[model samples]
Target: MQGPHSPAPPVDVQPASWRDLSSIRELEKLCFGRDAWPWIDTLAALTFPQTVRLKAVSDEFVVGFIFGDQRRLKRTGWIASIGVHPDYRRRGIGRTLLVACEDLLGMPRVRLSLRGSNDAALRLYQQAGYVRIDTWKRYYRDGEDAIIMEKVR
Candidate 1:
């Protein structure tokens, strides 16, 4: 058993497959709660073509996940979702997943939306070179505005 001060286990970021459905579903619930995607959506995201699905595995368990939707015509990759298990926060896992998704997406521009009240997420995105470009009023189920952030290479 690891003590509170013990360093976290090594985490590996890799492509996620349909077999990760259950893990991803649980992660969605843990991360998004009411905003979590339906099972069908999660499955589709895992199986759909032209989408990037990645998972961060630590000690053989999924600790984080990211989904990137590539829109060729729009010339932008949308970060459909990203979440790290609560216990894994502040360990650079989210940022690692974000960067991995961006690199694999190979798009000139990448975008994502988040609840405006998520200060930690905002800081992470900002530190990763994302800038707020727009706001969708009442975008979330609870009427929280969604802040749209974009990073351009």
Candidate 2:
């Protein structure tokens, strides 16, 4: 029998589609709380062209998600959102999703923004070679400052 100390199950990253809307929404809520995108925005990410959406699944459960937008004008892929279910964090799911999304985006550079107070996310981005590029004050609904980060190839 598995116990609390048991090893976590391995997850597979896969292309996400509209069918994953519900589970993705659930994961986002768990990861971002009040910052979670609305259902309509989630749907748009799944259905929109020039967007790369991916999910991490373990034992048939969606545990993480990422969305990236390909901007031809900028030759940069914008990582719009990325979240890992709380229970599945620290197992490398976020990094895997990020690498996969970046690969699929096929851009010369990538960018993303996160709440300035999200130190965990800041560390993750920094570890993945993202550098601070800019900051948008009161960028969130709750007036949290946004730190823009970018990775250039």
Candidate 3:
């Protein structure tokens, strides 16, 4: 028997593999909608040896995912993508996934781009210590501007 005030168990974070592509693709569609990457790019992120791919799994399904690209020459890492299933939002899953990718990237600075209109994402990134650095006008296919944010370690 458990007490009414008992805290829930913690979720697990792990490196994702190509086998997780299907689950990740589903989550991508749910979170990014029209901005989701194509299947080929998703596959590459999961299977590429040097790429950092992390997934937040609960109940044996992927709830969130993040991909990081390490640019050694540039001395920075870029967050290629991040997504949390709609059912899993606001539970710190996205933040956990981002932190895991940052750790794996092991770079001095990490950067990500988001639609300028995505207030929720902007707030999350801001709370996690990322600051807006630049903006790309009409960067998305739908002609939405993208705000670039960076966290220096």
Ranking by lDDT: 1, 2, 3
Clashes of each: 0, 0, 0
TM-score per candidate: 0.96, 0.96, 0.92
- TM-score of candidate 3 relative to the true fold: 0.92
User: Candidate 1 lDDT, tens digit per residue, 46-66?
Assistant: 999999999999999999999
Residue-level lDDT tens digits of model 2 in 47-100: 999999999999899999999999999899999999998888888999999999
Candidate 3, position 94, lDDT = 85
Clashing pairs in 3: none
- For residue 58, model 3's alpha carbon misses the true position, in angstroms, by 0.5
Q: In model 2, which runs have C-alpha deviations exceeding 4 angstroms?
A: 1-6
lDDT of each: 0.96, 0.94, 0.90
**Model 1 segments beyond 4 Å from truth?**
3-6
lDDT score at residue 62, model 3, on the 0-100 scale: 83
